[model samples]
Every structure is written in structure tokens, then in C-alpha cells.
Target: MIIELIVCFFATVSFGIIFSVPRNSLLLGGGIGSLAWAIYRLLPEYGVTSIFATSIASITAAMLAHFLARKYRIPATAFTIPGIIPLVPGSKAYYTMLAFVEGDYIGGLELGIVTMLQAGAIAAGIVFALAVFSFGKGIGHRYEGGR
Candidate 1:
């Protein structure tokens, strides 16, 4: 857990750097990314599926992004985009393609399905959070994470 935390924290910071996230927001964005990745890592040990885990973690990331965006007056994408880097299923996608190259059609298909589900879950979760927050803001909630 410690290693995963540290590695993801730095990885998120590096992603922020590469993406040119604002200097004032970079570390906070890294923090959101690290927290989201930690949630993704933790849920699997409890027997939760990766797709569910990814969705939950992504929801958490998006909510945090919205909260922090209002707090700091920065655009939420600065946090949301970098925050999801660690949750991306890069290795799974790679192996899915590799299986096809190795003539393992069934294996490739299974992996491809799971990978797509995880990706969809991430998108759905982010969108759900966005819609919720947008609705609240539109109604003049003024709920800036407790002001």
C-alpha cells in the first residue's frame, strides 16, 4: 500500500507536469489522483470487481475535483484529467491486444470486454458526478464543500 501510494502520487504529479496543469494546482491534483488510485487498489482486496472499483474511485475523484475547483477557483478538469491517470487500464488493454496477436481469440475477447467495461465505468462515474454537481450549482446551492 505504501509503495503503491508513493508511486501513484509521483506518477500523478508527473502526469500533471506533462499535461501542463497550473503550477498552483499541480500538487493538489496529484493528491486527488493518489487518493483515487488508492481507492482503486483497496477495493479489489475486498473481492469487489475492478469495474466497480474503477467507477467508485472515479466518482470520488470527480467529486473531489469539483470541491477543490470551487475552493481554489480553478477549472475542475485540471484535477479530473490528471486524477484518473492511475486508474487507466493500460496494462489490461495491452494484454488484450497481445492475446489477439498470440492467436488467443477467446482470451482476447474476454479481456477486451472487461477492459471496455472498466473504461465505461470510469466515464459513467465522472459524468454522474459532473451532472450532480452541475445541477446543484445551477440551483444556487452555494455548497462549496462547506464554504
Candidate 2:
């Protein structure tokens, strides 16, 4: 429980930094939501590993936020901050930046590759989300056509 809370807190803070959240409220709220999702994996049936599960969970939360923002008629970028809180890839990006700062060209190149991988992970998450969402849409359309 404690570990989860810490992860949530860190996730929120990371979200704030990533999305340029103006104050702590967005951070705290996003963190709490992300934490709730992380805790859900504690259930036996979820069969969740931290990497894949959290990626899916994070993207789900982000999509929910996207829907809400659309419903409320707000800028989608608003969701970018809190929505991306759980999966910001901060540590990897930071190390990549540090490598460049330290003048370690080879190390920087390696870190750059890791940074790209992290980006790919994020892109993969978005692609997976889109695929799931599209699959549901396809099923719905087929069912409606049958009617």
C-alpha cells in the first residue's frame, strides 16, 4: 500500500512536469487516479505485470481524460498533463539529457537509443489503445448493421 502510494505520488509529480500542470491539484488528482489503477492489479484476476499493465492502464486513463475533455469542450492538450502522468518516461529522458551534457558522445548515443525506445513504448501504447477502441467500434457497427 505504501509503495503504491509513493508510486502514485511520483507519477503525479512526473505528470505535472511533463504536461506543464500549473499547480499541484492536477498532479495530485492524476496521481491518485493512476495509483488507483496500479492498485487494481493487486486483484488476482487482472494478471498484470507492471510494464504492460501499467502501460495499458495509463493509456486507458489518458483516453478517459480525452473523452472527458471533449465532452466538456476543453483543449485536448489539457489532458496531456494529467493524462500522461503514469507513463512519462522521465528517468530515461533525464539520463539521455545528462549523457549529452556530460560530453559522453557514445554514452549519449546509447542513452538516446533508450530514449527513443521509451518513445516507441509510448507510441505503442497509443497504437494499442487505438486498436482496442477501433475494434469496439467495428463490432458495434457490425452489430448495428445486422439489426
Candidate 3:
């Protein structure tokens, strides 16, 4: 578990550098990625499916991105893009392509579908988080208008 978190942190930080995220924000981005990956890794022990786990992790990461963005006055993408890297289904996508290359149409099809579903889950999670944040922002605005 400790090893996993360490690896995730470095992986996210590397991605943040590659994406040109601000130097001051790299640690926060790495922390977010590690937290999301921790939740993802622990959920499977409790019988949570990969798709649902990925969705949950993405939501958590997105929410953190919003919080960090507001606090640091930077765009949320600085944190989000790198934060979600640890949860990406890279191995599954790789296997899907490998299956196709090996002429296993049925296996490739199955893996492709699963990969698509996982990607959709990640998108749904981000959308859900954004919706919640927007709703809260709207309410805050309404209250401030009365002042």
C-alpha cells in the first residue's frame, strides 16, 4: 500500500511536469492522485467493481481539483489531468490492442467494450462532480445577492 502510494505520487508528478503544471502545484496534484489511487486500490478488497471504483476515484479527484483550484487561483485542469492519471485503464487498453493484433477478434471486442465503459465511467464521475460544484456555486451566488 505504501509502495503503491509512492509510485502513484511520482507518476502524477511526472505527468504534471509533462503537462507543464505550475511547479508550486505539482505536490498538490501528486497528493490528489495518490489519494484517488488509494481509494481505487482499497475498494476492490471490499468487492467494488473496477468501473464503479474508477468512477468513485475520479469524482474524489475532481472535487479535490475544484477545491485546490479555488484556493490557489489556478485552473482546475492543473490538478485534474494529472490527478486522474493513476486511475486510467492503460493496461486494459494495451491488452485490447494486443488482442486485436493477435487476431483474437472476440477478445479484442470484449476488452474494447470494457475499456469504453471504464472511460465513460470516468467521464460520468467528472460530470457529476462538476454539476455538484456548479450547483453549490449557484446557491452561494444567490445568497450573496441578498447581501
Query: Using TM-score as the measure, what is the rank order of every candidate, best first?
Result: 1, 3, 2
Residue pairs clashing, model 1: none
Q: By summed lDDT, which 10 consecutive residues of candidate 1 come out lowest?
A: 135-144
Cα shift from native, residue 78, model 3 (Å): 0.8
The residue-by-residue lDDT of candidate 2 on 1-147, one tens digit each, is 667666776766666666665453465446545653554355325775445554665566656655655565655445545655555566877888898898988898887776676456556665665555456655544555545
| Selected candidate, larger TM-score, 1 vs 2 | 1
CA lDDT, every model vs. true structure: 0.91, 0.59, 0.91
Ranking by lDDT: 1, 3, 2
Angstrom error at residue 74, model 2: 9.4
**TM-score for all predictions?**
0.91, 0.50, 0.90
Top model number, lDDT: 1
**Candidate 3 C-alpha lDDT tens digits along 31-80:** 99999999889898999998889899999999999888989999888988
Question: Which residue pairs collide, candidate 3?
Answer: none
Q: Model 1 off-target regions past 4 Å? A: 136-147
Instruction: lDDT winner between 1 and 3, please give it.
Output: 1
> Which segments of candidate 2 are over 4 A away from where they belong?
1-33, 36-81, 136-147
